[model samples]
Target: MLCSCGSRPDRTGARRLVTPLDERIAALLLAEHAFAPATPGFVGVTVELPAALTGRHQLRHGFLSPRSPGTAALSGPPSPGLEAGIARMADDLDAATSLVGEVTPGGVRVALEAGLEGGGPLGLTRRWALAATLAPVLAAAFANSPSPEGWRSTRQARHRGLPVLRAVSDPRRAWAAYVLEQPGRGGPGLAGLARHVDALRPPVAARGHLEIDVADRQPRDGWRVVVAVTAVLLDDPRAAAAVEEITAPLAAEPALWERAARDALSDPVLAAAARACFVEAYGTLARHGARRDLRDQVAEFTERYVMRGRCPADDVLDAGAGFRPVPR
Candidate 1:
C-alpha cells in the first residue's frame, strides 16, 4: 500500500490556527533538507528498503510538496523498516525551516492507495466495487476532524462535490461517463482523460491502484493504526474475504457516505460493519505474524475507539475545547 499525509503548521500559541508555507518557502525547505531532485513544485527522496521486503516492487520514494499556502503534503509507500517512511518525511518537513521561520506541524490528513493484485479488466471492475463498499466503514471508524457542525469528519463532509464510486459491472464505461458528465471534461481523449482522472478526488479513486480517501487525518502516531488496519484488511486474504462480506449490506444504504461523516459510528449499520471489520483485521494481524508493535497498536485502537462505537473525533468533541495538537 502507498500512503500520503497532509499537515498544516500550527500557530505558535494558537494551536488551532495555522501558518502558511508559500511555494517559495517550500522550495527553500526542500533544498535545505536535500529532499531532491525537485519536480515542478514537489521535492522527493528515495527510501531504501531491504530486498526481502520490496520483492519485485521498486525502491520506495517519499515526496514533500505544498498542498496549499498553509498545508504540506508528504507521501510514500509503507515502510517495512524500523520507522514508517511517511513519518521520516514528516520529520524532515518539521525540521527544515531555512527560508521560512520555525513552524510546528499539526492536523495530519492521510490517504492510502492499495494496488490491484493482478492486472485485468475484470479485476479492475471488482477492485473498484470493493473499494466503494469498504469506504464508508473505514471513514466512520477513523473519523477525526470534528467540528461544531456535529460532523465527526468535517473534512470528509466538505468533499460533497467529489464523486462517489458505485459498484459497477464495467468500471471503465462508468469512469468514462463520469468524466464526460463534468463540464469541459468530455473533449479529453485517452491521455487527457488520464490527467482528468488524476485531478478528481473521489472517496475511492481508481488510479491503477485503488486510492481510499475516506479516513480523516489521524493524530500524531495514530496514523500508524490507520495504515496498519487498512493494509491488513485490504491485503490479507482472509481479512479481505471477511470485510467483503461485512460491508455488503452497506452498499445499498442511501446517503451512506454522508451518514458516515456526520454520525460516524453513532449510525447503527456503520458501527456494526466497522466493529466486524476491525475484529477481522485484528485477528488477521496476529495470525499473519505481523510486527508486535503494529498488532498492539491495532488492538489498542480497536479497544479505545472501534469497540466502543467511537472514533478519534469523539475524543476531540468530548473534550469540549478547541482542537489542540496531541504531543508527538
Candidate 2:
C-alpha cells in the first residue's frame, strides 16, 4: 500500500490508500527533498489558499537557504488529490508528455477555475501575452533541471525554441474566432476549452485565465517570481516596455528558448535581459507598497544571478548532477 497508516479518512469515511508507486515516490520526495523519475513523472501539490501576492525570492531561497524562513506553499507534501492526479494522468497517457511540474493528468496544464479580479477578459488576455513575452528570461533565471533523462542542460531540452504560444494577439478576435470556434468535449459553456490549450506552444489564455507556463518543477520560488513579474507588468506598462527593450535582441534569435535552457545566465544576452526585467519589476513592487522583505529577496536574486553571472542550473552542474531515481 502507498500509505502505511491509511489512518486519514476521506469525507466519506473511507481510507484512501495510494498506489504503491506513488506511496514510495512521495516518501522520497517528502523525506529527501529531491526525487527524479527516469520516465516522465512529477511530484506536485495544489494549495487551496486564496490568491495573494507572494514573495518569490523568499520562497525560492528559503527552500535553499538555511537562514531564511519558508512560505507555506514551499513546505508541504503533494496533496492527496494532486498525487492521485499525477498517477491517474500518467496511467492515462499513451505518449511522452511535457510540463514536468504539473499535477494535472495527461500533462494538460490547466489553471484552477478562477477569474482575475477587476480585469475584464480582454485586459486579462493582454497581460497573459505580456507574460509570454517575458518567459524566456524567466526560464533562464529559474532553470532547475539541468538534466532530464540523460540530456544535458535542461529537463525541457526536447521542447525548447518551440515559440511561446501567444493564443490571441487581438483579444476580441481570439474570443470570437479561436475560442468560440474550438469544439467542446467535457460539457457546456467552456467544457471544450482544453482543445485550445496547446493550440499555441505554451498557451496564452485558457477559458479566460492567463496560462503562464515556464520554469520546471521543485522550486515554487521561480514560479512565484514569474507570476509577480507578470502582475507588476500589468499594472505598470513602463516596466513592460523596459522588459521589451531588454529582450528585443534575444527575441530575434531563432534559438532563444534553447539558449535559455542550455546556457541560462552564463549567456550574456539572457543575463542582461533578466537583470533588466528584475530591475523594472523591483521598482514597480516598491512603488506599489510590496513588502520590504519581498523587495529585498528580489534584489537578492538579482545580485546572486545578474550581478555575479550565474543561474541555479550552474550550481547544480558544478556540484555534479544526475537523474533522480523513481521510488520502488
Candidate 3:
C-alpha cells in the first residue's frame, strides 16, 4: 500500500532492515583496511571518531584537521515517532563525545565532537540509525586541522551540497505540499525544510602537512590514511579472513594499492566487484520492498565501497577529495 506517503513505504523496521547484500559489499572495504598492516601497504579504519583523527594529527604535526565529514538521516513512518527518535539521537551524540578523553591523555590529544544535521528519510528512529551509521564515517574521514585553536577555514565540503541539491528534484520534497500546509518547518516546503538540515559539513584540506609525535618524541611530517570499512556483519564475523589476514601482508607488499590501481588499469575483477555490489544493492533494495526511494542512497554507497569512487552526493561537496571531515 502507498500508505499516506504518495510513494510506497519501506517495509523493514529501520534497525533490523539492512540488506544482506549491502553487508557483503561493505565487507570488502573493511578488508582493505584489514590488509593494510600485513601486505606492506596502508590499511584504513573509516569511522566517525573525531578523537582518533584529531589525536593522530596533533601528535604528528603539532596541529589537527578534518578532511570531510558526512551526515545521514533515516525517515521513519510518521511525525510522532520521528521526533522521539531524533531526540534520542541527539542525546547519543552528546554522550559519544565523552569518550574523547581516552586518547587525549596519552601524549597525543584526541577530541571528539558531534553535531546535528538535517534531511532525514521521514521516521525518527530510521534517521537516527542512519545518523549512527554516519558517526563512524565522520570519524574515519577526520583529517587536517590547524592547532589547539581550530583554524579559520575557507574550505567548504559538499555535505552541504547533498541536501541543498535536493532543491532541484526530490519526490519527497514534491510531496511536501501536503505535509506542510501549516507553519514552522511544516509546509510542502519540506524542500525548504530540507534546507534547514544540519548538513554535517567538514573543512577543506590542510595548509601544509601537520606533524605527529613519534617514538623519539620528535615531530614528523606525513599523512595518515583514512580507511573506510563497511559490511562488518556480512562475513560471519570471522569469515572476513580476507580482511583479517592482511595487516602483515600489506606491510610485506608495501605497495599493494598498486594492485588496486591495476584494477582500474586492467583488472576486470574491480569492475566485477563493483558490479556485484550494485546488483546486490539493487537486490537488497527490492527485497526490502524499496524499489525507488532507496535507489539513489544505495547506489551512492555502492560506489563508495565497491568502486572507491565518489557518490553524486559527495561530489557536490568536494568533487573527489573530501571523504574525511575533521573539525576546524
Q: Best by lDDT, which number? A: 1
Candidate 1 global CA lDDT score:
0.58
TM-score of 2: 0.52
Superposition error at 13 for model 3 (Å) = 59
Residue runs of model 1 more than 4 Å from their true location after superposition: 1-60, 77-122, 159-166, 182-195, 323-328
Model 3: per-residue Cα lDDT over 1-328, one tens digit each: 0111133336573333222222233233223221111111111111233343322232211123333342111111111221232233234334434434322111111111111123323222222232222222222222122112221111222121211111213222322232223233311222333322212122110001101111000011111111112221011123123222222122233222222221221234333433443444345445445435335544544555335532122232343343334232
Find the 10 residues in a row with the least total lDDT in model 2. Answer: 33-42
For candidate 3, the per-residue lDDT at 196 reads 22
Q: Write the per-residue lDDT of candidate 1 for residues 116-137, one digit (tens) a residue.
A: 3343322444555666788788
lDDT of 2 by residue, 1-328 (tens): 1223334578999986533323234333222211111111112322211112234323211111111232112222222222233333233221111212332211113231122322342244444455556677776776666663322235446447456535354443433343333443322112122333334334334333344445554233333344345445444556656665666555456676777777777778878877778888889888878767667767777787666767666666677764442111
Q: lDDT order of candidates, best first?
A: 1, 2, 3
* 209: Cα error in model 3, Å: 37
Report the number of clashing residue pairs per model: 0, 1, 61
- C-alpha lDDT of residue 268 in model 2: 83
Clashes, model 3: 61
